[model samples]
Target: MALVASLCNRVIVMYAGRIVEQGPTRAIFKNPQHPYTWSLLRSMPRMDEVGKERLVSIRGVPPDLGKLPTGCKFHPRCRFKVDRCLTEEPPLGEVDPEQLARCWVLMKNVSNPEMQS
Candidate 1:
């Protein structure tokens, strides 16, 4: 998947035709470290999380790209969203270790203890 996304020299992440996030695929995936990515990861059903029947999914259907909304495109379905998320669009930024995230929560400087080198 990373290989495919990298060939374009650009990744056009569309949240209703708005580029919520974009960057090198390796940077984005390895250290994605975004709240969106984190929520996305948490939503996945892990065998260890007892009682988990299936992977967790994002709350809402994808908005029609043709009818994109103003401000943050992810606020409606985002679990980590804050009041700021509702009114302002979060720019995609690097969160260190070559990771890029389009979320206010996970864009800060932090370390992932579970990530194995």
Candidate 2:
């Protein structure tokens, strides 16, 4: 994904009618902290020969934005959901010098630090 993004010189990630995360491909992929992006990265199957587990999937389909659910629309499918997610819309937050992620956990500084470089 980062390579694809790098070729374009720009990166944009969308979910549930919103740009959940966006930034330089290297920065975004190397430090993916958004739940949506994390899910995307985790969904990739391992290429090595070993006991690699099957890829994980993001549950449920995206909500119909025409009649989008009230408040945090992703609550139903987000594995890292919290009580705040049920009633509040999360704003995009600066996760690093050049990246932004829209997630309540990230917005409130509640998420774990991104995986080590």
Q: Against the true structure, whose lDDT is highest?
A: 2
> Which prediction has the highest TM-score against the true structure?
2
TM-score of 2: 0.78
TM-score of the candidate numbered 1?
A: 0.57
Candidate 2 residues 53-98, lDDT tens each?
Answer: 6667878887877988665677788777788888888888787777
Clashes of each: 1, 0
Off by over 4 Å in 2: 48-51, 107-117
Local distance difference test, per candidate? 0.58, 0.71
Per-candidate TM-scores read 0.57, 0.78
C-alpha lDDT of candidate 1 relative to the true structure: 0.58
Give lDDT tens digits, candidate 1, residues 13-95.
45555555556665554544554554454565555767845555667887777765566787777655668877778787665
